[model samples]
Target: MFDQLIAYLDSVRARDPAPRSRWEILLYPGVWALGFHRLAHWLFDGELYFLARFVNHLSRWLTAIDIHPGAKIGRNLFIDHGFTVIGETAEIGDNVTIYQCVTLGGTNPTNGVGGKRHPTLKDNVIIGSGAQIIGPIVVGERARVGANAVVTDDVPEGATMIGLKARSTLVPAETWLREFIPYGTPCDEPCEQGNGGVERVEALERELAELRAEVAALKEERQVPARSRKTGAAS
Candidate 1:
């Protein structure tokens, strides 16, 4: 158990640079939260729903992070900082790094039946702060979700997702091969101005040009009619 704890702390240290020592990492709210979650999940598995819920609420109160007792989390699932929420049916894989203010939220089924409604994060996935991953989507292995992205669809392996609607950005092989990326964003490239943004900008520009041409033609038509009426009146 001590060896496992050391390994977990080392994993967190690899992802985070702020921690000076394993002792410091141990004091982190994410670490404490994960510990409480383990107890809660154990209780939940034994059908002690009330005790599980009690532990979950206590963890939330202490750590400011809410992870449902029913959520299945794998080893070294690091939650950097706090204010993160994992839904009941959410499944997190090994070495998945989630930043502050992120949500692995579930979709509301119209039939109102309880099932797998939350997201599943594959191994080595990194989620940035304030990102919302909704629905029962699969975030593929080694995928990176940028800060403030809203994802509702399945992310492909090794892809980098960005923007409000969360469009995939092509990442260079060198960047993708890196061990870890801070904030799940590539510093070498502009994430917000991706291919999708460029295409949308071009489309909007084309539409604006077409509208301008139509407006000019209408003005010309009105001017011609007014000139003809003036000429007839003068004659």
Candidate 2:
């Protein structure tokens, strides 16, 4: 048990540079929240729903992180900072790193039956702060969700999702091969190819310029005809 704890702390240390020691990592709200969740999950599995909810509520009160007792979390799942919520039926695989203010939220069922409503995150996935991964989507292994992204679809393996209504970024080969990227966003210039918003803006600017030129030509033609008519009238 102590060995497992050490390993978990080491995993968090690898992802976060702020922690000075294992002791400091131990004091993190995320760590305490995970501990409470384990007990709550056990109770939930044993059909003690009330007790599981009780533990879950207590954990939320103490840590400011809400994790449903029915959520299945795998080993070394790290939640950096707090204000994160994992919904019921959400499945998180090993070494998944979730940042602050992220939600593993669910969609409302159409048939009034609650099945797998929440998302399933595969191993080594990283979710950036304020990311909303909604519905029964499967975020594939090594997938990265950028900060403030709203993902409603299944993410492919090693894909980096960014922007509102999240679209997949074109990750360079070098960036894709990297083991870790802070906040799931690549800092390199090559990764800018995925910025479709910039391209769209440039296209709009070109169209506006063309429209202005056409308007100027039409005005010049009309002015020439008016000048010719005035000269004929004067003659």
Candidate 3:
């Protein structure tokens, strides 16, 4: 029992809002996170929905962290510093990484008595900053949600999503950073479309390839042409 407490404390210190020494993290984070989750879970289980919401709201206001009471989060889930939110009825697997301003909410703003309403995040999922994952969708294991992405559909295992509307990108699963707290970076070459440079690059490559083929055909035509022998003139 004592050993578990010590370990939980260590994890908290390491992943809490404040950056502390190794020893400080080893002792603080566990206690804070545990306390927060316990209250949240307790309120969720209770029938007092209004009071539960009120408590959750107060907690978020005071801590800049908001988790709906009905959300089911597994053990050792680290909440890194930033604006964090969890939707009611959201089911999170163990060992998830959530950065600031991330939402795990349902699309239905009005409450319903349905089971498949909120997002279900599988184990080891990494959610980036300012990302909005709304609706009833499942984010598969080890899936990575990129910064400022608005996701509404289901994500497959090891998938990486990016952009406003949220499209899967070529970023590999291994390269995903667990704690991705994004800040605004000026775009050196923002695309005409919202997909940064991906769409533009593809278009340019296609055009260049066509141009090269056309040039080669023109050169071949200029070089050697069949002349009609009967015409007695270069055709």
| lDDT for model 1 | 0.96
Every model's Cα RMSD, please?
A: 7.4, 6.2, 8.5
1-235: candidate 1 lDDT, tens digit per residue: 9999999999999999898999999999999999999999999999999999999999999999999999999999999999999999999999999999999999999999979999999999999999999999999999999999999999999999999899999988989999899889997644464487788789999999999999999999999999999999999
Error of 3 at 140 (Å): 0.5
lDDT values, one for every candidate: 0.96, 0.95, 0.70
Stretches of candidate 3 off by over 4 Å are 9-34, 109-114, 172-235
Q: After superposing candidate 1 on the true structure, give the runs of residues whose Cα lies further than 4 Å from its correct spot.
A: 189-235
The candidate maximizing lDDT is: 1
Q: Candidate 2 residues 76-190, lDDT tens each?
A: 9989989999999999999999999999999999999999999999999999999999999999999999999999999999999999999998888888888777788776554
For all predicted structures, in order, the TM-scores are 0.80, 0.80, 0.64
Give the range where candidate 1 is weakest over 10 consecutive residues by summed lDDT: 188-197
Relative to the true structure, candidate 2 reaches a TM of 0.80
Tens digits of per-residue lDDT for model 3 on 130-167?
88899889999878788788899999987788887998
Reference-based lDDT, residue 106, model 1: 96
